[model samples]
Target chain A: TLAAPAIAQSAPELKWRLTSSFPKSLDTIFGAAEVFAKNVAEASDGKFQIQVFPAGEIVPGLQAADKVTDGTLEMAHTASYYYWGKDPTFAFATAVPFGLNSRQQNAWMYEGGGIDLMNEFYAAYNIHALPGGNTGAQMGGWFRKEIKTAADLKGVKMRIGGFGGKVIAKLGVVPQQIAGGDIYPALEKGTIDAAEWVGPYDDQKLGFNKVAPYYYYPGWWEGGPMLHFFINKAKWEGLPKNYQAIITGAAALANTDMQARYDHLNPGALKKLVADGAKLRPFSAEILEACFNAAKETYAEMNATNAAFKKVHDAVMAYRADAYLWQQVSEATFDNFMMAQQRKKAL
Target chain B: TLAAPAIAQSAPELKWRLTSSFPKSLDTIFGAAEVFAKNVAEASDGKFQIQVFPAGEIVPGLQAADKVTDGTLEMAHTASYYYWGKDPTFAFATAVPFGLNSRQQNAWMYEGGGIDLMNEFYAAYNIHALPGGNTGAQMGGWFRKEIKTAADLKGVKMRIGGFGGKVIAKLGVVPQQIAGGDIYPALEKGTIDAAEWVGPYDDQKLGFNKVAPYYYYPGWWEGGPMLHFFINKAKWEGLPKNYQAIITGAAALANTDMQARYDHLNPGALKKLVADGAKLRPFSAEILEACFNAAKETYAEMNATNAAFKKVHDAVMAYRADAYLWQQVSEATFDNFMMAQQRKKAL
Candidate 1:
C-alpha cells in the first residue's frame, strides 16, 4: 500500500559545507568527499547542495573532526585515526594495526556491532559517523633498500601513521608522523629510511616509487582504512527523513565507489611503477613476525591503560576471531590457488 | 544553487510488485528483496511502495527475469546466472566458474566497466540490472562422501547450477539441475549423490547437514555470486530522479548488508553444524585443480563459438587478471598470515 505523495513543490533548497582531511592533490582520498557531494546534488535534483573544501581550506586536515564536533562545520570527511591522540579508541573507528581488511571492516561496521560501538564512543563528541570511503589494503610504504630481517629495522626512521608507528617503534625502528604532502621529501632527503602512504594508486601520484625503488607491500598498519563522514549531531537530526536517506545513499555509494576505483587503478599504477624499475618485494617473514608480536604488545599496553581503548579493542578482537576463521577457509584458500595458477601461466 | 523541489504534494502514490527467484524460507537470500522494498518506501516517505513475492507466488523462480522484462512484474530479485541457460553470457553478470571474489566483483561491476558492458547486453532484453546482493565466497557444497581426488568425480550424480554443471560435466560428473525446494529431499532419498546450495547459513536452514555428513568448502564455482535487481526498462526510466536515487541507495545498502549478514551468520551456523556431528572437509587439491582446468577449457570453447559470451568473458577475464594480482599482494597476504596466527593461538 502506498501513501499519498507528500513532497512540497516549493521546498526550500539546503546547502552545507563539507571539510575533508585530505588535500586536493591526493584526489582519491579527498576526492571521495566531492563524489559524495556530487551524488547528493544529482540525486536531490539540485535541491540539496554541499560544497567540499580540501584540508586547509577550512580547518587543517587533522582538525576536521574537531570542527564538525564543535559545529563550526556541518560535517567532515576524515580518517578517524587522525584523532587517535585524543583517545586510542579513535583508532578503532578508522583502523587498528593488523586489523580487518576492507570487506571484514565493512562487515564489522555494518553487522558485527562496530557501528553501534563506535557511535557510542563518538556520541561523547556530539557527532554521528558514516563510513564514507575505503582505500583497500595499502602497500607497506616505499623503501630505499630491501629489509631482510627485524634487525634491519634498528635505527631506521620510517614515516608511518600514528598507531602503527607506535607498534613498529618497539621493533627498534624510529617512527615519524609526517603530513601526506611532506612524506616524499622526507624519504628523498634520507630523513626517513622508509615511508608508507596508501596503496599503488596514491603512491604513484606522490612519486614515491621514483625516490624509493623497493616497493614493499601489505601495509600491516592500515589494512582497509576507512574514511568517515562525521556529521554534527544536531545538524543531522534536524534534517527531513528524506534528506537523511539521501545522505545515507550518497555515503554508501561513495564508500563502494572509492574502493572499486582503487582496485581498478592500482593494478595499472603498479605495473607502471614496475616498468620504471621499481622492485616489488614482500616483507620478509621474520620482519612480519617481529611486527606482529610488537603490535600485540602495543595493543596490550593500550588496553591496560585506556578503558575506552580496551572496550573497543575487546570487541574488535572477538569479531575478528570469527571473521578470520571464515575468511581463511573461504577467501584465502580460493585466492591462494588462483593467484598461483595465474602467475604460473603468465610466466 | 538548489532548484525548487518540483514534487507535488498530491502526486499519486506509485505501487509496484517485485518477484523473487528464492523461496521465503531462505530468509537471508530472499529477504534481501524485502529489505530493499522497505528501505525504498521509508526513504521516499512511503510514496513509493513495492510488494515482494517469493518464488512460485506469481511465477516460477527461474522465470523471474522474463516476468520483469515483459512487465508482468515491475521488478524481480534473482541471480543473473540463473538464466545462463538462455545465454551463457548471462553468467558473467552473476558468477562464473572461478570468478572474482565479492570485493573484486564489486570493483569490476562498479568501476571496471562491468556495469556498462553488462547493461549493453541486457538492453537487448529490455531489462535493467542492479547489483542487489552477494553471498560472499560460498562453501563447496554438501557431499554424501568425501572426494579425495579428481577420479572421485567420475559418474557422480550431483546437483549444480547451469554453467558450473557444464564445466564439471567434462570431468566425468553427471550434473543435475534440481529445484531449490526439492534439493533436500533429493539428497536425502539418494536421488542426488551431492548438492550445492549456498554456504553454512543457508545450508543449515535447508537441513542438508542432517543427510550429508561431509561438508566441503570454497565454492569455487560461485565465488561471490551476486544477486541482481531486474527492472523493466520503461518502469525504471519513468521514475522521478529522486526516487531513482532512493532506489540506488536502497539497492546498494541491501547489497552490502546481505553479504555482511551472511558473513556474520555463517560463522555461527558453521560452528553449530560441526558440533552436530557434521564433518568439515576441504576438496582435495587434485579435485580443485581438475575442476579449474575443466572450467578454463569450458570458457575457451564457449568463447570460440558464442560471440556475445566471448565479448563479456574476455572483459571479465582481463579484469580478473589485474584484480587477482593486486588482491594476492594485499588481501591474501594479510588474511593468510593473520589466520595462521589465530589458528596457532587457538591450538
Candidate 2:
C-alpha cells in the first residue's frame, strides 16, 4: 500500500548520486544504475534525481564497495567477491566454485532469508544491499592452451574471483582477482595466462577473443554471479516508501533484463568466437576431479574457521544440495540425453 | 566446429507428440513444458519418446490459422479467448465482469482455459485446449476513472474478454482483447470498473495495490485473464514426443505452481488488499464514454470487416501495433519498481 499518498501540491525534491563498478559497455550490469536513476526520476516525476557514474570514473571496480562502505559516495555497484581479499566470508555474498546457478541464488537470497542474514553481515559496514542483477552460470575462463591434465594447471595464472581462486590456488596456480575492464590487459600482458569472466557476450565485448584464443566452458568458480546495488544504509532507510519500492523494482528489472540480454546475445557471440579461430575446449575429468576435491577441502576449512562463513555456507550448501538433486532428476537427465544424442565432430 | 560427420544415430528419435505454445517453463511463454517431460523418460533412458504440440497445439489458439490440426492430442492447455462464445472472443478465455481471481479461476480451470475457450470452441469440432495458466492482472479494470469529468468513460467497456458478458451489458461497455493472467479479473468484476491485462506482474497477481485504490490503472479491457496452450491441426501432426513436455513444465510450475498453489502463501496478501479494500468500485460515466469511443471506434468498425479480423476476430485481435515497445519502456519501468519494493505482498 505504498501507493502515492495524498501529498501537498508541492513537496520538496530529493537528489542522490550513485556509482557503479561496471562500464557502460556492459549494458546489463551498468544499465542497472541507469535504470535506478531513471525510475527514481519517473516515480517522483523528475522531482527525485540521481546521477550515475561508471567504474573508474570514481574508483577502481573492486574498490566500489569500500567506497560505498566508507560513504565516499552514497551508493555503488559491486560484486561481493572483490571484497573477499578483505574477508574470505565475502565469497558467499557473490558466489563460490561449483555453487548454485542463478535461480537457486535468487531463492536463497530472497525467499530463503539469505538476504536478512546477508544484511545482518553487511550492517557491519553501514550499507544496505538490494539484489541487483545476476549473470547466470558463467563459462570457464579463456585459456591460452587446452588443459590436458592437472599439470597444465600448475603455475597457470588465472583471474578468477572469490574462493574459487583460493581452491585453485591450492593446486599451485596463481589466482588473481582482476576487474572486468582490466582482465583483457592482464591476460594480454601475460600477467595472467588465463581468465574467466561471464558468458560469451560479455567476453566478446571485452574482446578477450583476441587475447585468449582457447575459450573454455563452465566457469566452475561462478555458476551464477550476482551483482549488488550498495546503497548507503542511512540513505536507504530515509527514503519515502514509494521511492524504496521504485528502487527495488528497478533492481529486479535489471536482474531479469540482464539475463535475457545475455541469453539472446551469447549464442551468436559464441558462434562468432569459434569462427574467429578461438579454440573451444572442455576441462578434462581428471582436472575437474582434483579441483572439486580442493573446493570441498577449502569450503570445509573456511567453515571450520569462520563462524559467519559457516552459517551462510551451510545454508547455501544445503539449498544447493537440494537444488542439485532436484535438477539432476528433472533437468539434467534430459539435458545429458540430448547431449549424448549429438556426437562430437571427429578431430 | 563440433558438427559431426553424420555417423547415423538410431535413425533419429523419430515421431513424437510435444504439446506447447512455448519452450520449457522457467521462461519463454509456457517454457516449463519443455523442461518437464525431457527429464522424466531420459532418466529412464529414452525408452519413452515424445512429439511436441505447440500453440494451435496441432492447430492455433486463435482459430483461423490452425483449424483442427494435430491428430494425436485428444487435448491441450490454452486460454478461452481463442474461441470466445464460439463468437464473443471474451467467453472462450475466462472472466470478462472481471471474473474470478487467478487462483479462484485456476481452481475453475485446473479444475480446466475455465471451461468456456473449451466447450464453446471445441464443441465446434474435433480438438480442445486446456487451461495452462492465470496471470492475475485485473485492475479496477483501467477506468478512464480518476474520472472527475463526465466525459471520463462515456462508453468504455474495454477490450474485456470473458467477464465482459456480465458488466459491459449494463454499462454500455464494449470490451476488447488483451491477455495477462494476473490483473484482468477485478476489472471485469467491475473494480476501476474497466481494465486491461498483460502488463506488469500479470496485474492479477500484483493485486492492483499501490497506484489504484481506485483500481483504475490498466484495465484497458483486461481483468487479469488466463492463457491456454492450443492443440490441433490434423491430430497434432500425428503424435510421438512421449506423453509430456507440452503440458508439464510451467503448467506444473506456472499454471498450477504459479498463482494457484502460491497465492495463499504470498506475503502481505490481505493487509495490502483491505487497507485499501482497494476501494472496489465500477467504471463511471463519462470516463467509460471516452474509452468506449477509443475502444469501440478502434474495434467496433473493424469487427465489421477487416480481412485479418474477418479471418481471426473470433479468436485473436490484429496484433496491437505497439504492444512490445510500450511493454519495454514506461510499462516495464513502473511495474518493476513496484515489484522489488513490495516485499512479496498478496494481490
The best candidate in terms of lDDT: 1
Off by over 4 Å in 1: A1-12, B1-5, B9-12
Listed models, DockQ each: 0.61, 0.02
Q: Write the per-residue lDDT of candidate 1 for residues B1-347, one digit (tens) a residue.
A: 14223454222378999999999888988888988898777766677889999999999989999998888999999999988888899999889989888888888998889888898899888888989889998888888988888888898899987888899898888999887789999989999889988888888878888898888878899888999999998988888877777788778878887887888888788888888877888887788888888998999899999999999998888888888877788667777778887788631
User: What is the Cα-based lDDT of residue A185 in candidate 1?
Assistant: 91
Q: Which stretches of candidate 2 lie over 4 Å from their true place?
A: A1-12, A177-191, A333-347, B1-347
lDDT of each: 0.84, 0.53
TM-score of model 1 (CA atoms): 0.96
Per-residue lDDT for A1-347 in model 2, tens only? 22122221122367777788878888767876775576546534455578888887878777788777887888887788778877676777677876766655665775566678888888888889877766766777788777888888999999876677889998888988676779888888888899987777677878887888987766667767788888888878877654564555455545544544554455456667777877877666567667767887998898888898898888877666544433322122222221222222100
TM-score of chain A of each: 0.95, 0.89
lDDT of 1 by residue, A99-163 (tens): 88888888889888988889889999988999988998888888888888889889989988789
